[model samples]
Target: MGFRAMVCHRFSKLVLLSAAFISLVVNAAPWPDGAKIAVTLTFDLDAETIWWNDADTMTGNPGSLSYGTYGPKVAVPKILALLEKHDVRATFFIPSWVAEQYPDAVRSIAAAGHEIGAHGVRHVSPLQLTPEQEAATFSESVRVLDRIAGKRPVGYRAPSWAVSNATLKLAARAGFLYSSNMMDADDPYIHNDPPGLVELPVSWVLDDAPYFWFDEDSWNKTIHSAASVKAIWQEEFEAAYHGSGYLNLTMHPQIIGRPARLLMLDEFIGWMKRHEGVWLTTGSAVAVYVRGQQGRSP
Candidate 1:
């Protein structure tokens, strides 16, 4: 063959080899066995603010109160009942104030064999606070959660999904083992931050808060209809079932506790139970499993 043709052939071979290697690297990561799907049901209990405070008498409707209409009184019992009925455990992310005010409720969750983690001290977003302020808030939250649960919280979900670099550092400094702040990926992976906390990326698409709080107009129009929401959930579940990826479903007691909303939740749970090989567990359990796998790998 001519020299020019030989050079072109070698370049083509190199390109093909590089592409094959890249593909292998992308698909080489092993997913967890047994359907490779872990369904984490996380509830954010944040009802301590003025709009949600039982003592607060705010007649006019506020943005925060828009979602706060569903409080502990309406949410806790239903959630407990659902968990018990389904024989499933969940992670309840409670604000420090809620833990203090509803000790009985918190105790009930712990007694039910579920995991309890810190949501925040008050329901304030982490982005709103300066680094120093955020650190102080995080420290107090950890102390309060530990006091309430009788153990240091191993996980955290930033209030409003509001996270920053400083917020992540604060979480690690506070000794959290995992944080569900980043939405970069669907799988649970470790972030090499200072405290080296694991990042269990919770999908905003899987959460009900954004629909209710952020898109009030659209949510109001579709709040009664569970078809769209359920379809997306089922699709994600099926994809994860096939791909062996993690499926995390997030909800709030106040939002999903209403009679109509509860029906939607029930339907979704029913659908989930019909499937085989799905691992329904708490966020902490999934994190622990992933960490264990990492430890065993060479």
Candidate 2:
């Protein structure tokens, strides 16, 4: 075996298989203009402070607090006119006491441009507070959603996503750039134990509050059928549009703003608007495009 030491071991195995296929095509096209799949239609709105955050799952029964005041007094203007008839730019989070008891429906979901974030000031569950009461509930939920949603909420969605092993270092010291209360991963990750922060992950089977929540003290949840939860969210957005992964849909505005579950979320947003590299964004524009594709900054 001496043809110049077998051509220098086949040129170091072709430079380690061309650096592992250019790191698998740069982590399989991490979406932007050349998108492949990154949809986020989030919403937490948790009105009536999600039933007073816990008195053993409080059911003080004013018809269970008017079922959380039918989410901003009648389902957030029918989920903001079905996301302004699908012009789409979704992401709502809120719980600064449901934005101080519906500050004009959270200022009309931030004047319909959407993207509010921070969901805690009464929806509780920083696993029962006390890291100085969850850092004074994230500084009074960023000073009450920046004095009633006048902008100042990068992101943070815990209250019931229940994080407390120092909830991502107190949401990166109360200045979150991302943290959709974690589920682990479908993509988006950058948290070297509180290094620059960015997580954008969530799931409970693409969450519609465990198949459309209803309660008279949790009547063993059955009401499902918005055409079977939009056929399980169009099969998890066609398996994240064939693996470019990231779906992140968690809804509630008193349970999918019921009108047959908002027309099954307007026919599942016209089946994800006949997909084609889908990047229907907003969880802070997918956490600022995953922190500008991991170069990282805010």
Candidate 3:
């Protein structure tokens, strides 16, 4: 090739590479006050309601209720004390019936200055309901949770992490500021639905249930060890921290609240605290900040 042609081709390649690098830098920019990443600890306190209400799986197996009761009866306080000791704020998503039956328990979580988001009434999945039914359930749940918690919850997560398109619109219409059911990205974004509610993504790998919850009577399944969980979570945190993205770790009082698991959890938090530039907050607070982030962008 001619020298002139070779030089021009090299110049064009350099320009393209520079533009791509610039885009990555912009997308991975630090959060407020130069925080490299945002870390949130969220728990879905399904409790006994997850089993007692499921006639197909839990019906006639009255013993299962006792098994589930560990969440509010024992596990919650352990989880709360740990969080308080760490000086970390978290978000708790509660099913309405659990809150109604265990108002004191739910109230304790709220009292600790943590964000409470709706999980749904009776732990029913929106996928099981007609769109209208889902919308009605969401609206009524918002009302009940507000009454019990004494604050209008601005966030909602479908009983299961899976959600239909209708769920997004219905949640937004029901006065939710964000939905944590979707897993489109590691970082938060605005849903395309009208009013554009913030989308705080969740993943199974980041959840405690798949790793800690065990079944002996039926499925007879057990999950990873506490050491494995702590190691994997730390690995994930390091990657997200360097990318300057958001990390939402989903935990469960009934699962991760076990003494050993709780210790592992504490270890993970201690690791996070030692890391600089990590902004720890609740899912709703993340939504509010992300919305402001959208507004400030040119």
**Could you say which candidate leads in TM-score?**
3
Per-model TM values vs. the true structure: 0.80, 0.34, 0.87
Q: Which tens-of-lDDT digit does each residue in 47-67 have in candidate 2?
A: 776665364464455766777
Judge candidate 1 at residue 1 and give its lDDT.
Answer: 11
Worst ten in a row by lDDT for model 2: 1-10
Instruction: Encode model 1's per-residue lDDT on 161-258: one tens digit a residue.
Output: 88965988888878788888777665676564442467778787888765544444454433435667777778888887666367777788877677
lDDT of 3 by residue, 1-298 (tens): 1111000110111111132333111222246677778898999988876666563364535676776788899999998899999999999999887888899988999999999999988777777889988888787888888999999999888887758758888888888999998765677766545455888888888888888777755776777899998888888998887763678988878888788999999889988989987888999888887766553322
Q: Backbone collision count in every prediction?
A: 0, 0, 0
* Shift in Å, residue 249, candidate 3: 0.9
Error of 2 at 37 (Å): 2.1
Top candidate (lDDT): 3
Against the true structure, candidate 1 reaches a TM-score of 0.80
Clashing pairs in 3: none
Which stretch of 10 consecutive residues in model 1 shows the poorest summed lDDT? 1-10
